[model samples]
Target: MIDSPKPTSLKAVMETLNAQEAAKPSSGLTSKEKRARTVARLVLVQALYQMELTGTGVETVIREFSDHRFEGDLEGEKLADADEAFFGEGARAIVKEQATIDRLITDRLAAGWRIERLDTTVRAILRSGAWELKFRPDVAVEVVINEYVEIARAFYGETEARFVNGALDGIAKDTRG
Candidate 1:
């Protein structure tokens, strides 16, 4: 059984990560490594959502997740073991680079469709996907787009998933082109 880490303010999570060393994913991952990465992306989106909703800092969120959330079960649902480093590094980068990321997303958004107008969950999903597309060259753009689409589907219907796909697709073409 995993012990729940005490919840710190989400702001602490961002601050903690801001001070931590940079984290990045490596290539030539094994199947387990790939699964872990997938889990990391899912968790990253959740963390981002948590941060936005609570105005939490990146570091506190990452610590909370690493200590409590990464144990393969969240709220009685079994989860794949997540890549802690990837989650931490990605979270840090996402928060730190959020302005630039938001710009990328805003640029790809259809005219008159501001990113802020999107659902908070959808915004978090797009932010995570955009980060990977722009920064994680080790990961393929197709994989990044598909993974986030599935993540969106987990939280929403096909409409949102397709929206995530289209938004990330545009970002990928711009970044990975």
Candidate 2:
């Protein structure tokens, strides 16, 4: 008889990730408060997707997520707690500035692939990264690129991560330089 392990649910996967993050020796990330900003970036990508898929206003979705999703247990599982300010910044500012971001993304793409044709999750990663590169000069460019590349890996395989690296690298070079 053969027994196979059940597929890991997103919740269990996330819990494992949180534990792993807790275990990482605090070198560059000197405090949990600093780490929360990275958590907010990940959550911002997810919230951006939610806003696009649903017709929810940015403020409404942010309110809903802030009130009920960030710090509470929803559907019997603990929710991802992230920095509230960064979440609002990405959801509202990123979506609002999407047209400009898309233009930058479009310039970097190959001849046939339009930005709209890209996968939503991938697009979200790029948009958030682009937003940071163009707007958040306080964070270093390499830091912004690497963070989104990791986020891409969390959702996709090596191919997608490479793709993200290329696009973000191109944008970062053009914009940051």
Candidate 3:
């Protein structure tokens, strides 16, 4: 693939994702909206991580968490809605196409490492990568892979970033073809 600007810094990318969430009704987002989206992404990432670990339904986790933890603040309310749509769609799409995603990963592995044996964080990263690749085709594949790889590095470590990058690169190639 052609080289591109190193995907924006993690903070910047997360900010953009949050801005998109907050600016759903419009194209431009104010600083307040951007902050709300960042907060919302944090909550959604936690919820998605929980669901991945526990196998709970995404809606169930979202509802329970929002009702208990996010009921009061105005930003929370806005974020809850945006997070519900953004993460809900992503998690469900990952579930729906898991077989295809797994097959694609399996075909690309260097050997010994299996999708099933992946750590939760790596699995989550892979799921997010697959979701972006399949559903958000408007995003360039390199950006999708690079963004998630950065996420993996931040949340997990440099070692995990390599794994995420390799797996996603393989998945991107398979899906793009």
TM-score of each: 0.81, 0.79, 0.66
Computed on alpha carbons, the lDDT of every model, listed in order, comes to 0.75, 0.73, 0.61
Q: What is the lDDT of residue 45 in candidate 1?
A: 82
lDDT (10s digit) by residue, model 3, range 100-155: 76677677676787877876656666777776786767656755675576567656
How many clashing residue pairs appear in each of the predictions shown? 14, 0, 0
TM-score of candidate 2 relative to the true fold:
0.79
Q: Write the per-residue lDDT of candidate 2 for residues 57-140, one digit (tens) a residue.
A: 889878987877777642343445467888798788887898999888998899988988998778888999999988887777
Q: Top TM-score: which candidate number?
A: 1
lDDT score at residue 13, model 2, on the 0-100 scale = 37
Instruction: Say which prediction, candidate 2 or candidate 3, comes out ahead on lDDT.
Output: 2
- Model 1 residue 14 lDDT score: 26
Best-performing candidate as measured by lDDT: 1
Indicate the residue-level lDDT of 159 in model 2: 87
lDDT of candidate model 2 versus the reference: 0.73
